[model samples]
Target: MSDRFDPILLSELIASHKQKIADLGVVIRYNESFEELEDKLPIDSKAALTPHFATALNTYTSANAFWLGGFDEDDQLVALSAARLDDLGGQAMSEYLKRYWRRCYPAEDGDLAEASETQPRFWNEVRGRVAYYGDFHLKREGYQGRGLPKVFGPLAMLVGAQKWDADWYYTWVRERDWSMRYPLAYGFSRTYFPGLRWVKPPSSIEPDLAAGVNSRSDVLDWMETLSRPGEQALNK
Candidate 1:
């Protein structure tokens, strides 16, 4: 829980995180409340309002996307990140992101149509609360190595899980990108199901092949490092 963190330690961690990026000639701002972030996304983020990036913007039917932003010298929104806070404790979790896509895009693709039809089956294996770790975007190249992922990713997870009061955490990564995703989600187990995948590039992280956490301790343990180079399980 947020209470477990030492205020001074957390503040120091934040300052250090900012300094890492600032050293690369960038500025960062972390917003704890979704209200301030929901008001007019940055110019680079206008693509998100179009529904394709809604999940990245942290916009969900019954939830707000806890977000963080990085900007260039002129403050023009160079990098932005977010995580989804929604209930997958039951049918809610099943819909997770698919619902958002359907509501906004409305059966635009072959896979989405199939996913819409296959939604019920996907829910069968989903239960308990779930938080989605996603919506990370770097407007420009050469910035990822600036320690931004380490700085923003976990902080987004920390805030989003706290915001939604969720201990169940998960994220999507296409199988094609396994090398990158698996390392980030070390403590989560992959849950496979029928048609439980991204509708478009369903293979993006492999459908139903998503990762999840069962309790707060796991979330906390993982957050201790976010992702260690070769962590084999929830804990040593």
Candidate 2:
């Protein structure tokens, strides 16, 4: 864990979030096995598992990445989220994405090269240690409207912050999910429209996305908020 924050307060904040979700019959645990974790993800007609966290495509270990699995009373995996450290010493995120867009979204092949040219203004400001978050999936059967995200999302980012001390927490989400306020529930401070675009994008993934962002200060403030009275547990 990073030493930038108070250890005592950090522990308390994490415990508080854990307890809040525990009431919903969910137990959260950290895992480093991306290969196994990927197998556990729900296989549905959504965007294919992101290559950013796929073990076959990229490298993510205990040293630089972490995945959180939320299981229920039956010990069945129901929610998933992961983050990885993108250390760009002095490079802009847009430039980095331009070069790796194919690696990150290999499923989209036709006109994939066009993705490199599309950049949101906010992308230029992202630099240094970045906690690139993705691979978030939550079953909708019994977990949709129970306020799982209120705690789960923040808890994921909190764990990411502890591990990376990242300058920013960033992700690209479907525009519909953004319209549904998923990013806000995930603790991102800002959301930029048309984050990533393509001229003839494949139908497998959304052609456009809303980029979610959360600065280090924003994360710290969230932890402080949870430490206060009446905010220890989120409402259902």
Candidate 3:
């Protein structure tokens, strides 16, 4: 999609979200190093770095991917998110995944053949310059019920769009996260069940997954709603 946003309005909305998080006693930093980010992730994190952002195996320059971390009063990393440009050009998302499933999520004796058969019908229609946001984590101790997702969701998409001019934003959501209705909280408008059907799934990761998607137009409209005067968008 074209960059149709008002720079001033975008800046204001981004600042507003950052301020909201700061009020919760978290400091945000735009990190350029994925290695540092991988190191900073909690050792016991169930949501470990996916192969999409694995620096050891993949090279992500500033133009393609970006990561950020939030720190508390003691400078401890408490929350984090990352986004990357998945340039599909004219290929369907389902086809792209089928071609790169092992590269994206490497596992021995894995089965990804079901993707071609069971993927949502919309996957064939979704293509071109997709911004994939993932690696969202929170420290659970004091972050829950604080409305951080509302802030992080929009802020991450806006930044990704600004950098990549992505047509669509998508991510793979865990089954539990979907059950909790976090997709709605994250400003995603559409969700598809059984986004990826693995026949021989790995025991290390959550087997079931759903897809969260938002068109650039949808995100722009959401920003417009949030930027309206007296809206109090993030709080809701």
Best by lDDT: 2
For model 1, the local distance difference test gives 0.51
TM-score of 1: 0.60
How many angstroms is residue 106 displaced in model 2 relative to the true structure, after the best TM-score fit?
A: 4.3
Better model by lDDT: candidate 1 vs candidate 3: 3
TM-score of each: 0.60, 0.87, 0.87
Residues 140-212, model 2: lDDT tens digits: 8887889888889888888887777788888878989999888877878788887875654544567778899
Could you give candidate 1's per-residue lDDT for residues 168-210 as a string of tens digits? 6665444444445542533344433232444454322234444
Among all windows of 10 consecutive residues in model 1, the one with the lowest summed lDDT is 186-195
Model 1 segments beyond 4 Å from truth?
1-16, 31-46, 49-63, 88-92, 95-101, 104-112, 116-128, 142-144, 182-215, 226-236
The predicted structure with the larger lDDT, 2 or 3, is 2
In candidate 2, stretches whose alpha carbon ends up further than 4 angstroms from where it belongs are: 1-4, 43-48, 106-113, 116-118, 199-203, 229-236
lDDT of each: 0.51, 0.77, 0.76
**What digit string (tens of lDDT, one per residue) describes model 3 on residues 37-133?**
8777672353458776778777888778898778899988888888988789999887787666654553445543223445667788779988888
In candidate 3, the residue pairs with backbone N, CA or C atoms under 3 Å apart (3 or more residues apart, or in different chains) clash, namely none
**Candidate numbers sorted by lDDT from highest down:** 2, 3, 1
